[model samples]
Target: MGNAQDKPPGTGGGGGRSDQATAGSGARGRAGGSAEKAQTHKASEKRVANGRENSPAGGQGQQGSPAVDTSYLDAPSGALPPHLARLKNEGNHLFKHGQFGDALEKYTHAIDGCAEAGIDSPEDLCILYSNRAACYLKDGNSTDCIQDCTKALELQPYSLKALLRRAIAYESLERYRKAYVDYKTVLQIDTGVQAAHDSVHRITKMLIEQDGPGWRENLPDIPAVPLSVQQHHREKPISVEVAQARAARAAQEEVRKKEACFTLLKREGNDLVKKGHFQEALQKYNECLSLKSDECALYTNRAICFLKLNHFEEAKQDCDSALQLEPSNKKAFYRRALAYKGLQDYLSASSDLQEVLQLDPNVREAEQELEVVTGLLRQSLMDSSAHTPRV
Candidate 1:
């Protein structure tokens, strides 16, 4: 975001000499005429000097005459015209000095020159627009900033600077949604931009509050970042500290996404359980456990699904796991008791039910179930004794 101005290529020039002595004599003779006549003579002499400088035959000429400054007549190969390049360089200098207004004028002049001269170099034009956009942003003219940035982007779609500038402009204008999209897109292009990461995080909360859970559906289409842009970013040089920070931020973002996914799956599992869709709930819980295997709630929640599905062994296993994580969980104890009863293990059922009561004595359901289980146990023992042979 600093400066955001484009640097112009270096200018070069060839030397030439002009016979200004003759022009000077003529000007002296015409001094009695209108000032316009003398001015025209001076301009003609300057043009002659420029023409001689550009001529292939022109070199150090007639021994004693002073050389004319013909540097303005030449531009670097494959660069913008000297006049336009000068404007751009001036703009960059002005921008660095915090003269944004003057910089804006210079960029505008360069852009106009490009149009007049039919200089259709997209890269050059894009830079001019982007530099001007920087000026607009500095001046707090966000609307103009957006417009210039858009123009720059149109000329060079993958312009990182223009995209960042436009995103800042959008945020300043309170167009949070667009700003968010641009910031996300910027990260896709170059993940090292901490500002984009921060802005995305800030805007995401605002959007979620404004549009509810379906906020993403209301956003504009975010274009996929090109692979070339990614490669370019990778090849770009960065400081060691910046690289380390970027990697750390990337890891944190990954964990945040994983946790968010886990929460969503857990919620969906709970909802499915409430709706009596035990199998679907089981699938959801399975995914949640994959993401967070040590979560006791996930095991307990899955145990309910297994119990509802009459998978007594699986239910008992899940309950056992939950208890291993939380020994005093009344729900785990009660659910395990139910699972044992389903397996026709009355003794184990009775033991788990008693444990549940020990943990939470006010659980009336456990008290009733324990009473029934104890009576069954007593009857089974008496019947066994009555039927016993000579052992």
Candidate 2:
């Protein structure tokens, strides 16, 4: 089998029997480790008993010691053992080479071995299931993908990869409501994750497309979010007026640092835009927005990237955000009008172009766009009239 470097994304193995237990021991099956140690202790005690019987003391302490149970000693520790590790490595190799069926077979063999050995570490099981889910997804078997990811999440509820994969599977099945819910879960787990945020935004639109305006109401009630993940973001409770003043000062300083960071990100995005790397530029803009969510210029910059990428809906959305921040922004109006034109919403395009003209009559680009949009609107009206029944 190949090394970890050879494994692809979503299929890489982490902890094994050889690896030390992580800080979150429960997740890593510490109980199973303790069971293994207890078995070893029993074996050592048996050796001592034999030694005592052979010695001149003649097992003096044997009568006083209570009998130890060895009933639970049959199973090995729950971590991935060497035999199963070989199977996983083979599977990862096959998966990397596009042999999903062969990879899945190896993974299945490993799973069967775990059951036989009573190795039921949730973390290990979750990794195997997620890797199998990745195979299912690659094979375009959305049903199997969903099943595998569901199994993975059952073992480890906060498995972000499993949730994301399941969301994608739901989307493939056209179960937009379920997809939206899963993506929302990912966002709640980590709000700073740009991909999760984008997935949530995209799936919400998909839900609306399938279920209309009140699509959110059709979704299942979201479970109460676990507070464990949010602990990092909570500030220390403050009561003293002087301490409050110091905290306010620190908050102001943080805001200044964030602004400085945003400026650097915006410059990077602009550079990427100039180099015709619209996708990379969009990523920069997304990171910038995460830092300063309400910055109108960030939205405007991102809208330009979306426009260049031909993602008119996303472009329109960014433009809307920009306009909400500053309605008088000419760039926002102009970019939105371009997106509307791209979407063939000629009336909206024309209206936005008129706004651009009102904002600056001498803007030749706006004037030209208005002419083109007006012609399209007139043509659309004529076509509609021709299709209508005579009154």
Candidate 3:
């Protein structure tokens, strides 16, 4: 009974072991096939989603597949996704190298990704739009540039770069009035932007020629910059060189304005003098002098006003100031002579007339006045001697 139960060891036991090994191998083979099929399906889906299936190189082997960018997958949580950041950086790099078309594509991809990701960050969106607008501008697509710039402005109002780019686009489109308004708004936001200042001037000339004196009325109302934006610009750090340049430009602008005001006032004063409105002319001259205190011509012109008004002392003082500024000013010498005559100082008047003649012998008025003053001085001296008692 024991020998029957044991069987032959090699025949039964060895055969049993062999059958178990075969079964286990088959199970593993089937599982491996399923895993390989799943992997192939996943790779196919990725290629389809990336739109590479129909690409010219897609028919090639795996080596022809587009390089996968898995950098975003390793991004740390709670920060801007690595993919978006990478796109922006690559766009900037391309733009710096003057590959505007390529940069534009990069920015477009990033913008679309942001939209799909539901990113609503105003500052980030604004920068992307503005950058795209710059690319459009470079491509000579004014319409698209304006649209992108407008979108940027809407996202971040008072954006200086957006306003400037939009203004340029509008000008390129021959929308002069809108361009003028946008440039003006840019200046209000940042007076230091020389490009904005120049654009405003150029557009103003175009608008004036197009719409005449009513150009301003035809312009769209300019929006006021928010206080927050103004404060932000004011508080922003600037390099030393930039700060110096800005200060120099501001000083030059101030000088230009003052000179213009001085010219206008001086012209008005001269007109009033021609009309014999001496008092009003004197007021205008005073304003002119206030604007240009060191101007020798201003002092001489004001002295004429004083003389016409019969303010002899004031006229004399103005002539004195004019002479101090220009020692050989013929106008000052002649005017001072008239002032002395008005004050009944015949001796001083005669001496000033001689000085005027010495400066310019062709001054007929001075020659005539000298004769009259000489006669008065001689008569006064004789009268004084006649009134003197014997000593």
Candidate 4:
């Protein structure tokens, strides 16, 4: 979520002098000074009522300029096709007033207008899907975001925006191999697209460092921008279901072909973790951890596996590691305490059991363990005290 408090310069969301700026959806009718008639409009007259230049991003401009430019009264956005533009302009007006959810409705209205106007081509609809996808992403609808990106890709298989967005969705869904492939493709499409190239390099290096398999190496080389597919005859766009399958398969196949890029791969080690292999539900949890070791739950999960395998030391170590990462983790404390008890380290077991009680006093299990450990510790202490010389 590269979203800062405000839009960055040159992104065109708000602020700065970039002709090519990105206008986020959600600009519509809101109360303000007159946006039409007798207004003294000049070239570069800063018609940025709700304009990106005059947007919140650029709102905090040069301090010397005293009175804020209160010229126009609408949000800033790219020019739409005619009548639709006017409608969006009104929406921008509302958006500038910080009416987000409402403004979104207006933006949808504009899209509907475009659709009604018979301007529904792959290229045209792709742009629409991209814009809508941005909206859904902002609203935190992962499913919708994926759907829109898929639709956009169907229109323009090589849409850079779609590829980047799809990669983001994959990353969120813990599909790293797919993200890597998308980044690689983005680089090929535009050799100068450094960000994509850098992401691919970094993630790939990380996987390799973890002894991740060769599937990553053998991943299909995709460009930063997709090559133009011959549009000999126009056809209706593919459905959302097809698009999703394509995205999943594209990512799944990439990983399936070679070594697994997930921690489950480490556990399975080229045996069951190979291509087209079905991973159980826990496999997802393991894969997530391999990409990032800081998650507490993953450690607990692995500890469970160790416990099942009767690897008491390994289980204790994982519990300790998890506790180190997140001190207040009750589950880690409880599990580690159990692991210590299993290893017959009564002192360490008692200590962890006590801490678990402190964190969650209602745990009947921890209480029972505490009762049992306390008697053992006290008896041991008594024996030791008896042996000590009266110094």
User: Which stretch of 10 consecutive residues in model 3 shows the poorest summed lDDT?
Assistant: 1-10
Question: In model 1, where do residues sit more than 4 Å from their true spots?
Answer: 1-192, 196-234, 237-239
**Candidate 2's residue-wise lDDT over 282-360, tens digit each?**
9999999888899899898899999999999999999999999999999999999999999999999999999988999
Off by more than 4 A, model 4? 1-80, 87-104, 209-211, 217-391
Question: Model 4: which ten-residue window has the lowest total lDDT?
Answer: 1-10
**Model 2: what TM-score?**
0.41
Candidate 1 Cα deviation (angstroms), residue 287: 0.9
lDDT for residue 319 in candidate 2, whole number 0-100:
93
- Residue 108 of model 4, lDDT score: 55
Pick out the ten consecutive residues of candidate 2 with the lowest summed lDDT. Answer: 1-10
lDDT by residue (tens digit), candidate 4, 96-119: 555444344444555555554655
TM-score of each: 0.45, 0.41, 0.47, 0.35
lDDT of 3 at 277: 93
Each model's lDDT comes to: 0.75, 0.70, 0.72, 0.57
Residue clash pairs of candidate 3: none
Candidate 2, residue 352: Cα displacement in angstroms equals 48
